[model samples]
Target: MTSEETEEVVETTTDSSTGAARITAAPYMPGKTFTNMFEKYATDGLPDVFDISFFGNISGSTIAQIRSTMRYFDLIDDQYVPTDLMKELVGTDEETRKGLLKMMVEEKYPDALGLSQNATSGQLAKVFNERGLTGATVDKAISFYLHMLDYLSIPYSSHFKKRRPSSNGGARRRAAKKAAEPTPPPVHTPVKPKVSTEEEQKAAYVQTLLDLAKKDGADADLQDRIFDRIEKALGIGGGPAAPTTTGGGTTDSP
Candidate 1:
């Protein structure tokens, strides 16, 4: 067939199982069109133990093959694999690898086959009918589930190894809150100077008066006289006597 005829035939056979509305041919490539390979190989029933065991082994092999294929496709850069599940599988003993994959498939991807631990085949079959969990998308679903398990393991094992994150954001927030709050000012005791006793005060007063008298200035003498007058008026002696008057209007001169 001519290239045009081949293109037309390819276009006619294209299928749309995913969300896209139409299937299109690969640009500039004849007989090389997109296909839902996942849907093509996907199954709704839980796989039996034999198939489970086989696929577990198959996945590891496929992972290696995919890596090799990706290299061929020039897709390898930096690191081809993020998580080491594939690498672990490659290094692990076949029996252990099989058991691990089986456990994962049984626990997580049970609906893909009719052999899950929790749900019966009939129940899963009904779910597949209602939700249309076709075989084509099973690989993606499985990959997604395994990726989630790996994510969970990363944090879990890090904690188990005591590699906790250094910065606790919650603790930081609490500290910041404490810092933001207003603090009460410190209470301080007032210092009191030593006070003189009454006797000490009287001695000081007498000294001040004597000092004023000895000072040669007129202002100093005036201050001394004022203080002396105050002392006499307070009945300390030398003030004129106050005269007494009788209520009968007669005064006796003494």
Candidate 2:
């Protein structure tokens, strides 16, 4: 062990019951996985080696977990040969199965179980940690243990019974959903409003005057003034010059 790992080990406290655990690591796989393996194998009879040939289509890692779980419960010997306990634990008689299951818990996890008939998940985890389990292994181990407890009708406080998770579910769901969605449309930039220039305003004013002058009610005098205004506005050499005299003599034009 590295000095750091030794230090971590030194930090852990061991209960007498914890020290009694036969296996080094907890079965981090689902308890049901291996329990089912045991029951089905009991139906088919024991294998010569609990290897790929026996387990069939599952991954190597999963086979290792099954082997580890079997070791934890003392269900198999060093050669991975099924012990009599393995067969009896999966037998048809409920009473025999329950007895063996209880005995297995007392042997493997008396530390946490002895703490309380109803210890919370946190309490159980602390016991596992003290037994040198760490990282993601800790939670997974706790899950398997909890499943065993439930299977034997053992009640615990402070944990809602958790369903076994679908493998890598959240990430798989997010990836699938992302692939299925269509790409978003490109953002639309709004067109800026066109501002009228001062020259444009002036031209518009001149045009309005011209249009009014063309109206029927406009007398020639009014039309002339309007045209003068238009000429001045357009800078057509017309300025605010003196008013011209009209046929009306002294013109009323100011």
Candidate 3:
């Protein structure tokens, strides 16, 4: 069968559990809820077997939400065992963990991330509310997601951060004035010219050959031949360039 047909079949089968039709009605859980679950699993240790009862005091629906989120992130395998990603997350340094989490969110929750980018919690909450999500639930979810962003040191809308009230209200007025002011046109800096040294030029030539080989579907033997020709032409590997006699003067053919 053709690759496209094979892909379509695989997608159709996979979608039986996690397809668009199924996802549309999936429960929405905030980023904070996910982080909380991760922390719980870390502290208590992820059980070898999946057990709804392991989540003490948490509702069955909440457990289901957590499980769905985990599955969506590919953190758990078909047998519910923690995947390599989950193990890496648990063993990695804080910065590495944050990077992994950020990547996960970008990959799995890009829509929500895009909505939240440069938007205040209230603005994000409004978007969810418009989509028929409960106000309280939306607020909680947005708050949690924002918290996750902060933990990851990812920059977001500055308006989301809490500001102290100015005693004289001067700071607020100045901020408003600044916002009202027209932005200045950006200045373009002239690029400095780069001069490639002899070694750099040789390196660039070699790279060009490699790129051409890749583009032309060169086999190992063809690539080796190309490299051999280059070496011989460059007088490398004890090979000297052929000398040409032009106007009774000898010059290397290069």
Candidate 4:
């Protein structure tokens, strides 16, 4: 059936207590043990009487508790025959079965189940004791019902398994080492000198003027004028060679 249909079934199915008092005399039965019993019953049908041998080599008292617990939940009839509810549960899907089980618990034992849903077994015991119910017996009953609920995938908090401590000591050491180490300084790249297009043009002009001045038969005065003009355009103060004497010596004051 669809989940919605299953939920409708659960919602419609009410308590079938038949004026019978809720079972509070049984010890807590593990969810797996109850599952085993249901599986066996589904195959072989309900037994004439509670039998420890049928379940494991468990105690006789444990067997009686299991039987009483089953009856209290209305899973079996007075004749020890599997009821219609048990029959329906036998082959239902997991989610549907859980829904049904939750509905059954809520309807049949509203007070105990409602209280257990929010409180621990010990805390629930105190509340039940105030109501004149045997605290220990009520505690065990709450535990058994809670286990069944858990097995059926109902949302209920229970004792959590302790987690083991991690053993990656080397990883922790490496992490500590990384944190303790200092950060390195950032790297800087050296800047290169740049020559502008204007400077390049001025250099070419100076070179060309010098070459012209060095040519054979070039006029000394003309070469001096060209050198002076080139030096001025290039932002330089020095002029070219001064006029030479007929003996090829520089004319300087003695």
User: What is the TM-score of each predicted model, taking all chains together?
Assistant: 0.20, 0.54, 0.44, 0.42
Q: Score residue 93 of candidate 3 by CA lDDT.
A: 65
How would you encode candidate 1's per-residue C-alpha lDDT over 202-245 as one tens digit per residue?
45445555566567774855876746744643458667422233
Mark the regions of model 3 whose C-alpha exceeds 4 Å error after superposition.
1-33, 36-44, 77-79, 115-123, 126-132, 160-254
Output the TM-score of candidate 2. Answer: 0.54
* Regions of candidate 2 where Cα sits further than 4 Å from its true position: 1-24, 117-120, 160-254
Score candidate 3 by TM-score against the native: 0.44
Which ten-residue region of model 2 has the weakest summed lDDT? 3-12
Any runs in candidate 4 off by more than 4 Å, and if so which? 1-27, 43-58, 113-123, 130-136, 156-254
Cα lDDT, model 2, residue 187: 97
lDDT of each candidate versus the true structure: 0.38, 0.66, 0.58, 0.57
Q: Compose the digit string of candidate 2's lDDT tens values, residues 10-36.
A: 122444776732434566788787556
How big is the positional error of residue 33 in model 1, measured in Å on the Cα after superposition? 22
lDDT of 3 by residue, 1-254 (tens): 42211111100112455554211221256666676655666777767755554667876666666665566667776555788888778666667878898897666444455664467656655554544446344554456566777777777777655422224566778999999999999999999977655555555555655675675677888778667656764778666543333455335321
Residue 14, model 2, lDDT: 41
Ranking by TM-score: 2, 3, 4, 1
